[model samples]
Target: MELDDDSANGLLRSFGRQVQALRIRRGMSKAELGAELSYSQSQIGSIEIGRRVMQSDAIDRADAVLDAGGVLIAMKEQVERAGFPKFFRDARRYEAKAVELHVYATQAVPGLLQTADYMQGVIRMERPQPPAHVMEQHITSRLERQKLFDRDPAVSMSFVVEENLLRRTFGNLDMMREQWERLLELGRRHHIELQVMPTACAEHAGMDGPFTLMETDQGQRIAYVEVQRVSRLHTDRKHVRELELKYGIIRAQALSPSASL
Candidate 1:
């Protein structure tokens, strides 16, 4: 489960303190711990300060290296979950298990497609902006989602993005070019389809707003919709079916993958 930001920050710092204490009790310096973990002293410093998120393997190594006796290991899942906003945690879980995902993105480029620079740019522009630690975690967690492409049974994915959204200069010219290059590279993948909804289109089916239709590994279909950071995963068959059909229409109306690229 995802905790509120304050709670998450508290937990992360608490965990960091525990790791720090264990290191000190072992009569070891951060450099020594990093050597054992094959991480740099700076990386160890970041983790110790709760400013960096670590992977499962790194946690295991840290657990063994710091002699924490599974204390740090036990906090693995919970610590990672804190990186995401509470409203989006459930959807993030299902998305990881998805066998098929179709995204209609109306705002910025969908998370799965965003370049790191583009992702950071959008996060920084958010209202009531997140603190530095939270912002780093946000980018890390979202980037972690891209690992879906590396899964054993890859998730077949498609996206229909607003053309105007692509035209927006999220950063300077170089960054924009990099983002477009990233998009073009992704569009070349066989299992993935990328389409653009041109502003010139007179007939549009996605006007109701952006939504994601996902089919899980078990063949269960679901729909995810979010607005203002409030996210919903609709598992009801009726609603999921409606979204599936709506997505078909949106794809039909959008420019083809080749044209989009």
Candidate 2:
């Protein structure tokens, strides 16, 4: 499962090169390193070949075992930051800095609001299924993004989801029930406003698609729109203003926060 072009300067490949070089300098076989880190030899080999994402604790343990002087630990941030796809990187950065978020979801639950089981089910349904390890990396990365909800100065957020999404079963009955319960829990948060847009609603403004509008700490506003595999972050004032207006309308048409639950 090793990547063919490890010489390319991507973060994962670069990290793999560092790990391989350090392991060699220490005269440790992959099996020995895996034993020290309590991982399988194949796991260590995959990480060393840029085919697997290294968990933070694993990187820390590797740093110690290889006597890397914090080099691997320092690279952990970059590795985590690069966990998301290239198209999502800009939006991820903006979202991390946002003080407020307005989101509209049509087809499925938004990533921020999805439970682990729900996320796995959604990812598993992709047209061309990904390898188990790659899927695990994506799930881990998404769950990490949800840490934003626990920030000291919590971000104020509002969401409008299509009613069909609530009825759709992802995972299984038990998982779907858990997801519904989680939605109710999130709706009760002081900084969060959750609304459901019933199919019966005649005046829906989100027919165009799913989008997010974010207000940064400095009060700068940006809009993110995604379809298929492509995404765009709109920074132009006019474009953002239009999305803001559309979101306002969508929220107005959605069921009240309490009623939606």
Candidate 3:
């Protein structure tokens, strides 16, 4: 689904702000809204900030409870576009509303948790020929995408990383150590789960590469597969279903979530 680039981002930001405004206009505190909808205060905050995806059920309840305008309901189609690509403008839209995210990365640490220094080193190595400013822009964009994890209450995130990522030198040894430590901190968080797939793990589906699967509130799911320079979104029923099964298996085969670090 092609979208006007600016329109997509604008709509997303507006949707997030509107949700928060609607709740406030209705005199609904975050806790009250959560109580009414069975969502935690943090979950509600994430949804309001557009750092998370809003579920259809949540929308319906919001409209009824807060007497929201048909604004959000009308935006559903665009919201679906959030699952359209990797590194896509819509990916953030999809992720903002996701209640859960399961990811598998074989080549590198997940982008959301990567440090600026680590990202800069990785970008320099991968695009050594690019001009300095070009590399800086790329690095800046990467850092901006990380705001997804900064929302209050945080999103429920699970990562399955290949052991190779730990040994890969993104920059200098010191930077690699810092990156690993960052990963360890994220791993210990209450809402984050990190799993490592041992190098010796028998051949598996993820051997092909990294992918992320996100589940929205209304139970719809989207799969994002990334390659070196391109990422594809799998929205077809059969493709999505197949990935779901594969992801379940990978999660089971990977090291226990606690030991991934």
Question: Which stretches in model 3 have alpha-carbon errors above 4 Å?
Answer: 1-87
Clashes of 3: 6
Name the lDDT of candidate 1.
0.86
Summing lDDT over every window of 10 consecutive residues in candidate 2, give the lowest-scoring window: 1-10
Can you rank all candidates by TM-score, best first? Answer: 1, 2, 3
Best by TM-score: 1
**Lowest-lDDT window of 10 residues in candidate 1?**
1-10
Cα lDDT of candidate 3 equals 0.73
Give the whole-model CA lDDT for all candidates, comma-separated: 0.86, 0.86, 0.73
**Which lDDT tens digits does candidate 3 get at residues 6-40?**
55455556777887898888888999988887788
Candidate 1 segments whose C-alpha is farther than 4 A from its true place: 25-27, 35-40, 64-71
Give me the runs in candidate 2 sitting further than 4 Å from their true place.
Answer: 1-9, 17-46, 55-70
- After the best TM-score superposition of candidate 2, give how far the Cα of residue 250 lies from its true spot, in angstroms: 0.9
Give the TM-score (vs. native) of candidate 1: 0.89
Tens-place lDDT digits, model 1, residues 1-261: 547777777777777788899999999999998888887898778778888776556789989887889999999877766667777777877887799989999989998888889999999999999888778788877887788877776679999999999889977989989999999988898889999999999999988999998888888888999999888889999989898888999999999998988
